[model samples]
Every structure is written in C-alpha cells, then in structure tokens.
Target: MSEAVEPSEWQPDWLSELVNRSTRSAILSTPFTSDQTEGHLPAPSEQQNDPISSGNSANASQPPLADSESTHIFDYREETRLPVTPSGERSVRRTLKGIHLFVRIEILYHNAPRSSNQMITVNATLGTGLYWRGGQILELGGPLAVLVSFLVVGLLSWAVMQCITEMLCIWPIPGALSVYVSQFVDEELGITVGITYWFTYSMSFSTLVATSAAEFNFWRGINDSRTIQGVVIYFLIPLILVLLNTMRIQIYGWLEVATGSLKIFFLIFIIIALIAINLGAGSKESLHYGAENWGSPTDFDRDAADNWVISLLMSISIATFAYVGVEVVSSSVLEAKSPNLSKGGGNPFKFSAIYIPVFATVAYCLSGVLGTLDIAWNHPHLPRLSWLPPDLNKDDKSPSRAAFVVIALASNIPGLDDTFNAFLVFTCLSCAATNLYVASRTLFGLTSRLEGGEGRRWYLRVLASFGKTDGRQVPLRAMIFSAVAFWWFVEVLSEMASVSVLHVWACECLAFIRFYRCIYQHREYLERENIALVQRWSVKNYSDYPYRSYGQPLLAYLALSGCIFVLLVANGAALWNGFHLLPFLASYLTVIVFIGIWILLKIFRSAPWSFVDLSQPKRVAEIFRHLHDIRLGGTDSTEDISEG
Candidate 1:
C-alpha cells in the first residue's frame, strides 16, 4: 500500500556517529496519510517548494529532499482511527480497551522508574520530609508519616491527570503542552510552557545523575574510595544510555518494560518483607505487636503560626514532588488505535492499570512501614526496632539509602543489603537514562512548527542543528547535550520538582479552556461554509469525540485551582523552619522562573491574543471524517476526503 523507496543517500557527518541512535518510528511512520496532515506541512511560499509533493507528479522546480531516507524531524502525526469491529457489532469505533505495551513505555517510562527510585530514598528525598517536621525536614522518621504522605501525593497527582487527559486527546501531537497552548491560547505560551517543561525534565535528569553518584557512595569505602568511583559512574552512565537509546522504539519500549517490571517486583517484595518483619514472621522471638504502631504523636511542635496544618500542607506539597513525572501521559501521547483517550473517559488500559498499580503499591508499602513506626507505641526494647533507618538530620544528611538501611538492620538474610543497594543503583541508572530520552524528544518537538503554528522557529533551528539525528528519528545530539548538562546540577533545581510540575499542570488547564472555545468556533466555521459534516456536532456540545475528555471546563478549573492552592502554600514549611531570605526565594523559584520565561517570550514574540489559529483542522469532525470513510469500507474513488 506504500510507495517504493528510493536508494539510501550518504549520511551527514554529524549524524553519522549517532546513526545507531535513531528509531523504527522511521520504519513504521506513514506521514501525512491524509490531506489534513499534508495541508499544514507548508504555508503559501513553502508549499510551492515542498519536496514531498503528495499528489503532485511534475514539480520540476522543486529540489529533491537532502536524503531519500531521511525522516521528517517534527513529524507530529497521530493515527486516531481505532480498529473497528465486524458487521456483528454495533458500537462504532470501539477502543483497544486493554493495555498496549508500546503505550505503557511512552507514559510510564518517565515517572515509574524514577518514582520507584523515590521509594528507596523515601526517608531522605525532600518529598516525605513533610511528615517529620520535628525530626528531619527531608527524612522519613516514624512509620505513620510515610503512609499519609504516599496517599496524599497519589491523590493530588490523580487530580492533575484528570485535567490533562482531555487536552492531550484533543491535540495528540508531539510538541504536547507547548504546541496545544500555542494553538488554543497563544504562541508565547506555547514557547515558554514548552521550554519550562523541557527545562524541568532536563533538571530532573541532571539531579538523577547526581543522585546516581550518591547511590554509588553507599557502596564505596568511607575512606574516600567513593570520590573516584562516583566520578567514574557520573560520566559513564550517561554515555551508556546515549548509546542504548540509539536503537529503535521497540527496543526502547522493551527496555522500559523489563526495567519497570523488575523495579515493581523489587518494591513489592520489599513491602511483603516489611509486613512479615512487622508480624515477627522471620524473627527468633516471632513478635506480633499488631497495629500498636498506628497510635499517636508523642509530642506536639507548633509552627510559626502555632498550627500543625502548615506542617501538613508543606508535607503534601513535598509529597507531590514524588509524583512529578506522571504527566508524561499528556506529554508523550502515543499513537493509540482507539478513540482519542481524552474523549473516551480516560485510558482504560495503561493509565489505570500499569501506572496506578506500581505507584500505588510503592506508596502503600512505604507508608505501611512509616505509619506503623510513627504511631506504634515505644518498642525500643524490641530488637527489631533496632533495624529501622536512622533519622536524616540536616547536619548528618547523606544519601537517604532508607530501603537498604532497613534491609541491613532488620533481616538476617546474608546478601539482602548488598542486593538491595545494587538494585537501587540499577534503578537510578535506568531512570536517569529514560529521563534524558524523554527530555530529548521534548526538545526536538519544540523546534518544529507543530501543526502549522508559530513554533520556536529560529530557536528550534539552532537546537536541532546540534540535537537531531541524520535519520531524523532519535535526537541523539539532544541526548548528548543533556548528558553534558548533567554535571551542572544545582541544589535549588532539585528542590523545584513539585513547583515545576504544578506549573505545567496549570498551563494544561488554561490550554483546555481555550481549546474548548476553539472547537466551538471551528464548528461554526464549518456551518457558515455549508460543509457536509461527518460527526454531527449539531448542538452546543458535541458528544461525537471518539474519546471525549471526562470533565472539561469544570474539572479543568478544579485541577487548576488545586494547583494554584498548592503552589501558594507549598513554601510555608521552608519559610517557617528557617525564616531566611535565600530559602524563601528558592521556595517560589520555579514559579518565578516560569513566569519570568513567559514574560520574556511575551515581550520578544509579542503574540497577539486575538491571533490564535483555530483553522488547523484539529477539530473532531475533521479528524474523524477520513476514519469514518475508511471504516465504511470506502476507497478514494468511493469517497472524496480531500479538503474543499
């Protein structure tokens, strides 16, 4: 059904070295399968010179594409037609319904591996510090705090997801938040929001690289053997990942699956082990001190405002950081052979199944241990209590190593501590590699004119010059750029994950409100033109979206309000704990930076609010027309799909 390919051309010198970094996305992609996609490929002038002239036969004036095999770099296409049923079934455009492996890799890879790593350091990473204000700001202390924080973060993340899914479905394109905002809202938003997202992911990856080095320190001798070994690992890990990512998407998906599954199984085992230990199952004494750990705080410490709520609020915000990468579902909207996920309630398969299970399981297990420990009446006499991880005070702050510490102290199993630390190292490496990979793609998408909008034209050109591959698949240059930047990790950036996440969540909500209006306007355009419609949006709100987002303006508003609420209150703990200038500034650093970037773009680009382009054929009616034609078993001769 596809055209025969031309012979391969010589590769560019720069891309030649990273040739292996490209993907099967080149092999599987069918660019501009319909006119809607091709229509946006060029404006008036470029249209005359466009090389991939879909239906044009004799374009003698145009030059050939540089390489016959070169894939288009900013290919933001989404194949939305679901595999339809046979004549026996009546429901139209039935979704794939269950988990698809490739889709899992796209969304889960960003959050799951890294979040799993978060579980290992639950006692130390600033996220759970919310629960233990009296002991250590960033360390998990007694068991009760862990359980409460886990559930709190999970619920907050779910709310953000509710807001994003619909917008992602509406414009299931690669540039993601930035691109959507540009189309629905304004170009300045598209540019700034996109860069903020890219910046957050990049910063997160760098912090992971730094964290990876710290994980190695746990194994190296205390006699300074750690310095050299940590340095070696810091440089080596990113190089290995850059090389690994050179392979195809299938390989990428498989790698995530293998790593994520192992990580999940490892965490699940840890939970069961803790529960067994709590019940005295493996102990010589077989102690069963049931639910005593879930009692009460021994002492009350009031905040600056003399209230405990400030401590709880700060903890919730910090806990929110643990769930940072969950929005990758929206950021990396994979090609689904189902009604667009947003319109159809939500992703029934991967979103609910794979993402939730691993994250929830980790939270539950970590919380179970923490909650029981915190509330359990003083059991200092019990030998098992000796195994609990030590408090991470500010002066003695090191790699939290909480999970490894717990295994070392609690269990008599000979190699468990070594084994657990080894696995933690592997998770850190895997998560860092995947984070870089995701960041590379986001960078690549930003440079392109995503769906014919005013993309980061000059900036994308500059970045792509150094970041793109010859095959135009993987952004190997971007990966290498990211790898080098890993060494430049800053402490403030590490502390800004929750703020960064909230920033993007707020943008997605705003974008959705504008998108709703654009869709309504597109319908009116069609009506005024007297165009024959496929999906009847015959009313004020059309129920024709193959995958309709669950709650639109209302739920979107709720999510936005929640994000704003958290952002405002998230900094109280830091302010109350030290009452210093730098910490206070750093607490709202992400918000300030986000706004600062947006303001700069507004001044430079000066994108007019009234100039929002709603004519890009992204409407549901336009999207579903060709799919409907194909589903009815019609060919080019049977139905004309070309735009009038």
Candidate 2:
C-alpha cells in the first residue's frame, strides 16, 4: 500500500480549493444570508446594541476556529477589503460582524422567539364584562335570576367555543370568524359579519373606556363632576390604549398576563371576602345573612315588573355581554406561536374553550349569590330603581353604586371600597385594551381580503392598505383607524355594546350551523361513492382530526336555537312596557346594519346572496383534501380553490 499523506498536506488544486471554500463558508453562514434563508440578516449595529447579546458575549465561550482553508480565505478577503478604510472604522466593523455572527448562530440554535406561547388568550377573555356588569345583572333580576341567566348563556357560550375551537385547530387563520362565515355561508354575510364584528368590538372598547373613567371617578370620590371623567375617558384612556397596542405584540401579551393574573387573584380574594361577610366576618354586629337576599327565583324587580318571564329573557341579553370576550380566544389563534393543534405542547385553544366559560359561569354565579346576600335587590341606593328620585339617581349612579361596591361600603371595613374600585379600574382598562386589539385585528382581517390591484377602486385600495403589517408584524394602520374612528362616541355607545354582542353571537351560531352542514354534506357525498372510501378518507370522521370536540352537530343545533331565542326576546321587555325609541333602536340597529351591509355589497360589488353550493361532489372532495393537507401540515396557504 502507498504511504498515507498527512491531513494538512492533502490540499486540492486552486480551483477545487476555491469551490470547496465557497461551499463551506456558504453553508456555515447560510442562516445570516438573506439570499440563502427566509430570515433576514440583522444589521451588525443591531447585534452590538442588543443588551442581551452584549451580556451573552461577556459570558459565552468563544466558538472553536474552523480547521479549514475556507476560514483563512475569508480572513484574507476581509483584511484586503479593510485596507482602504480607516483603522477605527475597520475595527468597529470587524467587532460588529463577529457579534452579529454569534447572535445569529445563537438565535438559530437556541432562543428563537415564539409568539404562540404567550398568555394572551385567557387574559383577553376575562375582560371588563364580569366586573362592570355584575351590578346591572343583579338589578335586572335577583340573585336567582342571575344564576339562571348565567347558566343558560354559559352553556350557549360553551357550545360556541366548542364549534370555534374545532375549526381553529384544523384551520387557524386571522379574522377567523369572518372567514368561516364567508366560506361556509356566503361572501355577503361574511363581509357583514366582519364589519359588524369590528364595529361591535370598537363600541365595546369605547364602553370599557368610559366605564374605566367612571370607576376612576368613583375611586377619587369625584362623582359630582363629569369634567375629570371626560378627560380620563376621551383623552387619557384612549391615548394610553393606542400607545400600548402600537407596540410589539409580545409586550401586549406580557401586559395582559400581568393584568389577567391580578384579575384572577382579585376574583379569588373577593369571593372569599364575600363568604366571610356572609358568615359574619367584617361585620361589627356579627350578623350572619346567608342566602336571605336571593328572594323568589322568578322575581321581576326592574323593567319587567309584572312579568318575570320577560325579566328573565332580558337578563339573558345582559349575561350574554359578560360572555362576549370569550370568543377573543378564537380571534387570537392566528397570532399564537404554534397555531397547529398537534405542534404545540398542549392545545391552548381547547384549554381556553373549556376554561373561559366554566370560570365565567362559576365566578358570576358565586358573585351573584354572595352579592345579593350582602345587598338586597330592592336596596334604596340601587342605581336603576324605578321609584328612586331623579336627582338621587342622576350622575352619582356610576360604578360607585355597583353591587360589589355597595356590599363593600356596608362591610364596615376601612378602605375596602377604594381597593375594590381600584381593581374595577384595572379590569376596565385591561378589557379596553383587549377590545382595541380584537377590533384592530378584525379590521385587518377584513381589509386583507379586499383586492387592491390597479383595476380596483381607490377606496378599495385605501382599505386594503390597512391589511399591510409593519416589520414587527403589528397592524399599525388598522389599529390607529379603529381607535380614531370610535374614540368620539365613547359615552354614547355604552348601551349599544350589549346589543351588538348579541348580534355577533347570533352570527357565530348561524356560521356554526353552516360549518356543520358542510361537514355533513361532505360525509354524505363520500358515503355514496363507496363505504370503504369513507374509512380510507379519514376526513369524514371527527375523531380522525387533530382536535375533535364532543357532541358536534347536535351541540351546534342547540346553540343556534338558543341564540335565536335570546336574540328575539332580548330587550323585548323594554318594547312591551312602552316603545322607547332609544332602547328599540339599540336593540335592532345591529340587525339593520347587518342587512344594510349585505344590500350595499350586492348593489355595488354584485356579491352573491346565496350560501356556498355544497351539491357538487368534486368541489366537496377538493375541500376535504385541502383540509387533509392542513391536517398534515403540508401547506400554509389560507385560501383554497373552493373559495373562488
């Protein structure tokens, strides 16, 4: 055998060596090169300026030098290029390149940023609804009424969550509500639902801001004057919310985590405090009043005086408001670090679906029971009492008169009312921020579907521009537009927010019916072809999906029927008592707006009025195949050929 050459002496010819060096260097620096990888290279200055990078550089061990000609060639190229530049500039460039290379490598190997793992879902769900509206629910019906209405709506909410979570798991997309409505139902309905949903969230945001301002005024004991409250609501609150939303989504997620944790702790503390007060804790006389204030289960204390049925029906509308933000979980799924159900460590969508309604129901039921026990339903200081003097109920009927606040005042504890009011303020602000986020995202989703080609109308192009995201992926323009559009109507839209929520839920229920119908039709089509084919094509069975909800089509049916009943009867008592223009308008305005949008789209854009056709087997098969592709993580395209 020939003698083996030394390792260092085995260099190839110049051409071969050059090719080898270029290939090796390219492979080593591929992650930092924009042409090679999808990720962009960070500027050298950015690496040097990053505090985390600087800290890591101070402690991290240096990487071993490459034992190849490629490294020496790269060094030689850099040395020759630097001779023309100043020594200081050359030194800085070299240092920055080194830091950048280190950082990019570390990021690729160790600490990639993940947006999905953030804790926004639960926090966004527990917004201003429960805290601000509890007293109102208590006043509409007694403690028993509160329990019934919450359970009724809570079950309805659970069904809606199930339907939404199942869809989101298989096809997580931004503006999910509108897209589902459009694809399963009709494009006209989808546009209406999207704009209506955006409007609803905007109104909710304003309502929360006003409520937060009212809470602040209550805490400061400035209930007599509207001046400070106006400033807080119109200027301060809106400005802060806009600023917060325009920042990175990660920052907003962290903020929600902090506020959401506070809300949870406060809920636990207040529940315990309520139990203690009922058991004679915090009372000087040691009086134990347990469940005495619940009164008759069918009592109609306000608005529906003689008819308990109407009172109960109307209370469902108020309770529905409390459950509105729960669907924010679905709206937020697209932003999650792992939208795929199987890829994430656990299914956050399912957890949110199960946790939110259960938590809201339990919390609302307990607070209702314990609150009415502390303060009678017919208490004199109740804000909405019919017999109360107009002057007494005038402007003083702010959050200071909330049932929990009234209970705290009667608890005889020092500073308890102030503390509770502070929590109320926190809840309102947190929710306002959430509402803004949801509204902006909805607008972004809506605008994204609009065509902005050269042939499109000017207004359409302008609208589509809102869909474009910044480098950080935040929809900055959409957020500003949403905030500016609704800020002026903060005080006026408070009453409309609850009714709008009903409209949104009704639309979602209708959308779920169509979604179920699509699946059923697809199954029927597959069964007719061949029984064996149904098993072969696993899309027919819900269990074969990545995430399957319990009690599917039947649950969807019940939810739709329940939603319809509530919509028809919601605020019916107000009209029956007498035709008050404001209540009637607030109750039916969203419906009118929904119809008007459909009509406008039809007239202008010639949009189709009917639901998507499900009769064609070939089309249905394609849709199912697309879903299968999604299940397999084989594609990232949000739209399919069937959408056209």
Error of 2 at 307 (Å): 2.0
Q: What lDDT score is found at residue 435 in candidate 2?
A: 77
Per-residue lDDT value at 384 in model 2: 56
- lDDT for each of the candidates? 0.45, 0.56
Q: How close is candidate 2 to the true structure, as a TM-score?
A: 0.74
Candidate 1 Cα misplacement greater than 4 A, ranges:
1-145, 220-223, 226-231, 281-293, 297-307, 334-400, 450-460, 517-544, 609-644
C-alpha RMSD of each candidate structure in angstroms: 11.3, 15.5
| Model 2: per-residue Cα lDDT over 1-644, one tens digit each | 32322212111111011212222222211111111121222343343432112222232222211112221111111110001011110110101111111111100011113333224444455555566566666666766777888888888888877777666655555577876676566766767788888888788777777767666667555666577666756787789988998776545555665666667788778888777877776763324333445435445564444577666776777777777776775455545543222133124455555556676778777777777677766554454523222444345443336677777888888888888778778777776777788788888767643445455457766886776566556778888888877666733265666666666666666766766665566665655542211222365433324456668678877877777777667655556765666666666766677788778866555445567766766554444433322222211111111121
What are the TM-scores, per candidate, against the unseen true structure?
0.67, 0.74
Q: Model 1 scores what on Cα lDDT?
A: 0.45
Give the alpha carbon lDDT tens digit for every residue of 259-298 in model 1.
6566556655655655665555444332333344334432
| TM-score, model 1 to reference | 0.67
- lDDT value, candidate 2, whole model: 0.56
